[model samples]
Target: MTKTVETPREREAALLIKAAASLQNIRDTWPQDFDQLSKALTFNRKLWTIFMSSAAMEDSPLPHQTRQNIVNLGLFILNQTRELTMEPQPQKLDGIININRQIAAGLRAMPA
Candidate 1:
């Protein structure tokens, strides 16, 4: 058996897409599915936290401006998650879902 190794961008894209799918699924079955909201949001939040931490690292491969942009975007995502957790609205997840999918698509477009 042979295993294919994924580049960092591909891995990140996969994670983001997975998080987005989880959020989207929760959104689809919301309130009745409220029990799952915290789990989904927590996973998404932790993923963004890891991204922010990596982007903030001094030795990160990303350029300073790009790293800063990622940190800022991560902050926005964190805030969005906080708001969603507080309110538990299905519509509130739209922006987060769009951002995740868009970022994932961009990551997937990058050359290895």
Candidate 2:
């Protein structure tokens, strides 16, 4: 029997999807599980932070434009997270969730 090993890209995609689902879950159960929002948002912020840092690295394999885009998107996500943290609004989660899912999809679609 042969076992397939997941590539780093696949792992990153999975993590992004997980983070999106966690945020969505907290949003869906808003008001009831407001505390959970902190956890979800923390995870998401940390993930994006890592991504941005990697993309910002000079040796990063991604194209210059792609890396810049990641950094830009990461900045947006961080700002959105800050707003959500202050306001605790359910609707504010849409952009973060959408970005995570979209980025994850793109990551997964790439040839590995």
Highest lDDT model number: 2
Q: Write the per-residue lDDT of candidate 1 for residues 1-112, one digit (tens) a residue.
A: 9999999899999999999999899889876887888898999999999999999999999999989999999999999998987877899999989999999999999887
- Superposing all C-alpha atoms, what RMSD in Å does each candidate have to the true structure? 1.0, 0.8
What is candidate 2's CA lDDT for residue 106? 99
lDDT of each residue in 35-68, candidate 2, tens digit only: 8999999999999999999999999999999999
lDDT of candidate 2 at residue 82, scale 0 to 100:
99
- State the TM-score for model 1: 0.95
TM-score of every model?
0.95, 0.96
Residue range with the least summed lDDT across 10 consecutive positions in model 2: 26-35
